[model samples]
Target: MMKNTRYITATVLDGNRLEIETPDLPIGQTIEVILVIPETLQASLTLSDRYAFLKLPIAERQKVLSMQAEAMIEHYENNTEWKDLMTGDIVEYSEP
Candidate 1:
């Protein structure tokens, strides 16, 4: 059997939820979902940092990312200071 594939970029919403829109696909149709965390957005690491991180085993890399996500969430939750410098629109991140 042949398979049709489509690629879409989506943002990870709060609570790790993703909202995918596939207008072409029929409603109630079964589709496979494979989440790819682009290296550029993986914890917002730098090029050199990502290179070093990619050296770790796959399992270890996952563990590290999970921990980083948890820490970031916790930091935001506990943080009370809102500096003027912190007020800004979120810009798309990319590696140089």
Candidate 2:
């Protein structure tokens, strides 16, 4: 897991007792949300099978994840300026 480079947050309230949430991370070519924990948590409010990630079909979940990622990528790419990875050219990333 990556630690604190950057992240996006989504807060969705699922009724009163449940809330849907995930950490949105930006990777090489896309942003990703980790819906599953690689290890167990150390609290009473542990995430389990009640989440949408596990409840929805994997394929449909992936589509939604992808949409979120694309929007996130577009957000930063549109909001910031970037220097060419190789060339010294400074370019403001504007969504076309």
Candidate 3:
């Protein structure tokens, strides 16, 4: 199971409860919340972090480019046409 961490600021409420307002996560998912002192907490990266690899240095960029090219070549070599599973055959699909 992959774990995700989110940093949020919540207001302390009466009766030992806290209220947090976040817009990213959808409703109905189980989440674990932990309390930490504001001064000691560091915020996690946002969705933009996924593309941070594009910011890599020149040598790293070359490595990434080479890997992408290799992957494209391998895909073209091993790819098969889409088929109809129930009919057990390759079927050309046309848009009406």
Give the per-residue lDDT digits (tens) of candidate 2, residues 1-96: 533423344454666343433445334445334542212332334467447456888876776666567765776688654534446767799899
Worst 10 residues of 3 by lDDT: 34-43
Tens digits of per-residue lDDT for model 1 on 1-96?
655756567898999999998888898999866455654666776799768779978966776676557656766688757555689898999999
lDDT of 1: 0.72
Can you give the TM-score per candidate against the true fold?
0.40, 0.32, 0.32
lDDT of each: 0.72, 0.52, 0.59
Model 1: residues >4 Å from true position, as ranges?
40-96
Ranking of all candidate structures by their lDDT, best first: 1, 3, 2
What is the lDDT for 37 in model 3?
Answer: 34
Per-residue error for 71 in candidate 3, Å, reads: 41
Q: In candidate 3, which residue pairs clash?
A: none
Q: Where does candidate 1 have its weakest 10-residue lDDT segment?
A: 32-41
Quote model 2's TM-score: 0.32
Number of the top lDDT candidate? 1
